[model samples]
Target chain A: MDSCQPDEKLDLAGVPCPQNSARTLIKLEGMDSGAMLEVIIDDGEPVKNVPPSVEEEGHRVVEKVRTGDRWKILIRRREE
Target chain B: MGIYLDNAATTRVDPAVASEVERVRRSAEGNASSIHQHGVNAAKHIEKARNIIAGSINAEAEEIVFTSGGTESNNTVLKGVVSLSSNEKKHIVISAIEHPSIIETARWLEEAGISVTYVSVDRDGFVSASDVEKALTAETVLVSIMHANNETGTIEPIKDIGRACTERGVLFHADACQSYTKIPLDVKEQNVDFITLNAHKIHGPKGVGALYVRKGVKIAPLLHGGEQEATLRSGTYNTEGIAGFGKAVEIAHTDDVKKMTELRDWFSKELSENIEGVLLNGPDTQRLSNIINLRIRSVDGNRLAAELDRRAISVGRGSSCSSSKSTPSHVLLALGMDSKEAEESIRISLNKWTRKKELGIVVKNMIEIVTELRMV
Candidate 1:
């Protein structure tokens, strides 16, 4: 995990579900294929909902780390 | 025919407005943005609609920017005004009982570091100008109050609040979706900077509304596109819908207000006089001509509305926006009612075409229904 550097990072700590996930997807959509993106989202709904939505869109969940009230999610954009 | 008592939720599109929509759709074949003859013809419909809406509100034609509906108009003013304000002018004031569009947008703004002050309304759902004045600070850049409460029908003191805001040098916005055609709104006389009007509420096409931004007020655009709406709201013009909206406005006469008021009062009187536990939620006076909100003792509003639906009589439990959720009405709660009382509240709105006989049938059904519901 330490060896992989993220191409993009997003802090959606205070943003609610759907919007948080939506912002993450929008950010991921702009990234180059195979590039990793880091996202910080609020716990509970955001944490539980965003990862599945991203994965369903064919992105790989590289890592998910819980950091206090938020979770840090690392995603790898799918190569189209 | 099934009765529709939920005009506050939305009204049936007027036949004239529907004809105008179809006419525009069939005749205007090009986008309003094009420079050709087709485009010119399409732009004519848009401009004519713009003039009609502007004239209806006593605003200049250049002041109206069309959008999808009331929600978008509300969003544009709240988001647009705040986004462009100086850092020192980061606060906005709104009534507590505002529509979800304003409330939700304000919440989103709060998340984005902007400060918000929600002025509470009275028991009758009227927001006092003084209370709004008390909430305003040097940092306050805008005050958004609805012209009438959609649930309770109580009209706010918009002119007083507008005057106060003018004196304070703060922008005032009124969501007049429910009151635009029913009430007389003169922008200059009211001293309001922005007023939101929608089509569906006034028997026009859905997905079309306009924001009346008083000339010289600068706000950021919510959507960035073809630089339409004088670069304030950019999108391809919705010509058919706007034309329908114009027709709706043109046909909405002041005489209809008298007819609606009479029917509303008659309905209220019949329900309250006949039903033992019927309670009028908002002020009997200064209310919107179309809306009548009530709370029946020991009754569940959701259950009542469902039963009405079952009988093909459509009514609303709360603001249709949030009624799907079981949460008690924020408007009712702000009006000092407990959750149970709020849960017991129902909103029945009449339109210009709402007949006397239909309401009589509704009253008869409600009287029987309330009695049956109370027993259980």
Candidate 2:
């Protein structure tokens, strides 16, 4: 394991989609293989959407935690 | 397909219109400005489109000036009409619940030192024709109002207001962007000097619209290049989109509108009956048949829309153009809604394709969602 800490963290609590998902995708694109990225997104749609969409891009969602109205998700980039 | 209830924002392109646009874009050739055979053919297509668009509204082809879309058409009319007037007559009047295109343009005109009178609307979102008559003066150069508001879908008394303006010797312009093709409009009967029309709202292609400038109404050009569109609007013609617009207009008949009205009434009645504390936002009569702006007591508009989307129901809450802004809808506020009611507002616009079963699904999902949200 390289580190427990995320290589990048995106706070998208109030950001809209396509924008929020786009930002998270951009961050994942810059990271290395198996690198962990933390994303904080709004509840409901974001929580349901971003993870599946990222996984569709071949990444892995390692963890997701609900904190109040927001969601904190940890994703690992796919190996190139 | 996801149950698309946001037809007011923009509609799905009709299949025939799409095919026509593709066929023209692929087969139709040459610049309309060219004098050669190809150019002549293209120009013929454009003129045919102009005639079709004009004929629908009972206006002459000379009165139609094609532009990018409703927004450009609106800006061109407002700025062009006001620009050519004498400096002493820089006053204009518009309703308070106008689309952002008119309202923001009026705000900019005020910044340029022109006087703008925003007339009030009733609780039902109808603008009083007499109020418009009272607001006019010798210094008032123009009266700009919407034929139907985008949010509330409130149909204004355009004939009354237009007649009043004509009697007062002031020009009347209506942004018919939301009502075009959905309703019948006669420029001559209404005495309107200018009216904006768009294709996309009627299942036509985007980036193409027209402005009806009445004969003998002298206005400055909004664009100056290539002298296209009779020197009023300039730029290479969007031949394909315009053709699609004409095709969409041709295929759009009054019969489809009846089906839409039925679906809208059924949906609204079902929603009202099933959902408690549901309040409507506009007048029941004299409103566009497709749109329904209703409010729930405890649900947040944005959150409700998002939840609906997750459930495969695409609806709009307030103006989609300005949804990012945290402020409540200006149109809702103008209708005497408190901030909370405004925040709770959701607009569900139906189209010809919307079905009875779809409306049932929407009502069931909406009732469940609102209840779930309020509990949260």
Candidate 3:
């Protein structure tokens, strides 16, 4: 699949870390299997932590886009 | 968390007080206004808490009127005085360095047809009694000054100012939210008619504070509802928070933060000796031991505060509650600091339990961060 549409999108640029990651995980958990969630996070710690943490929780990162100061990532929830 | 030195903004609740709050929450389930046994039991705890809080401030238990917190307590006095004053006596006298609660309330009152006189503090942040007296006029009905400033930690000369108000037949109110349990407050000896108190600043639960009104002083109620708190503040009692507040007050005075003073002096000395462009904001000897405000030349305060946060060390650049306004502190400006210096100022307040080892991290981080930022 190329440029697959996201099922949900969350903009968490100014939100702090750990909490932002937790909120992302919470959003993913409520989604159906194989659904894609798009997230926009701050450039530094949130970018470093959220994607890997999502993968650690068994999700797959399909896309990552960086534009200077912000990061946008597309994650597909793992099918059970 | 690396190091926490923001106690002036808010303190981490002591473990004992936290447990006490949980205990009251788990066991007490009665309204103090109800007529049942549970209600009576709950009321006893509230009164017991009241007695504990009043004892620390040298006020009678009956003199205490529980409000939401310091803001409400200050608002109650400022607004209540204006509403209750006669048309001919509608003037309010306050210091320039007061917290937003009193200052903003006074501003609102001015728009509502009351006169407000803002007395400026000295460069050292002390509002002298003579300045207050000069500000007083024939129509002045109330004078509200803080016991200690939140940003600069400067203690006001309330005893002299209180005397001036007393002699002039003006009711004096002190927002003692920053100094309530930390200092010896004898309302009678100080000639004060009203004083504000809060628990969270001293390691108690938040959302609970009280106003101490001299027995016969009449002020209109801000809330008009059920007959609670002697009809001065009417709301469902915050039983658990009050209980923890009582315990916090007990712990605050009995186990004094005397060591905090020594540790704070050591921290201040270390910072000034090690950091090149450091300037202490308030007087060296006349400020609160737990709070230290410093101005670092050539570094933005917000950047420094964020750098500290990235290193897991929490500190405050201004009044934590209203710093979102993103303006230089009015308190710092009142102390004669320019907007540039005021914007560059940061406040680090330590708690009673703060240790030297933790302070080591603060000093090392300050040297690194300030140096790195200046190079950039």
Query: What's the TM-score of chain A alone for every prediction?
Result: 0.93, 0.91, 0.92
Give the proportion of true interface contacts each model preserves, from 0 to 1. Answer: 0.00, 0.00, 0.00
lDDT of 3 by residue, B25-48 (tens): 988798765534466446656776
Docking class of 3: incorrect
TM-score (chain A) of candidate 1? 0.93
lDDT by residue (tens digit), candidate 1, B244-345: 999999999989999999999998889889988889999989999998889999999999999999899999998899888989999999999999999999
User: Arrange candidates by lDDT, highest first: which order?
Assistant: 1, 2, 3
Q: In order, what lDDT does every prediction score?
A: 0.88, 0.86, 0.86
Cα error of candidate 3 at position B301, Å: 1.2
C-alpha lDDT of residue A3 in model 3 = 58
lDDT of 1 at A52: 80
lDDT of 2 by residue, B1-376 (tens): 6799999999999999999999889876888666444554565567667778999989977689999999998888778878999857589999999989889999999999889999999999999999999999878998999999998899999999999999999999999988988888999788899999999999999999999999789988889998887688889989899989999999998888888888888888998899888888898888898999988888898899999999999988798787879999999999998889899998999888888998899899999998898889
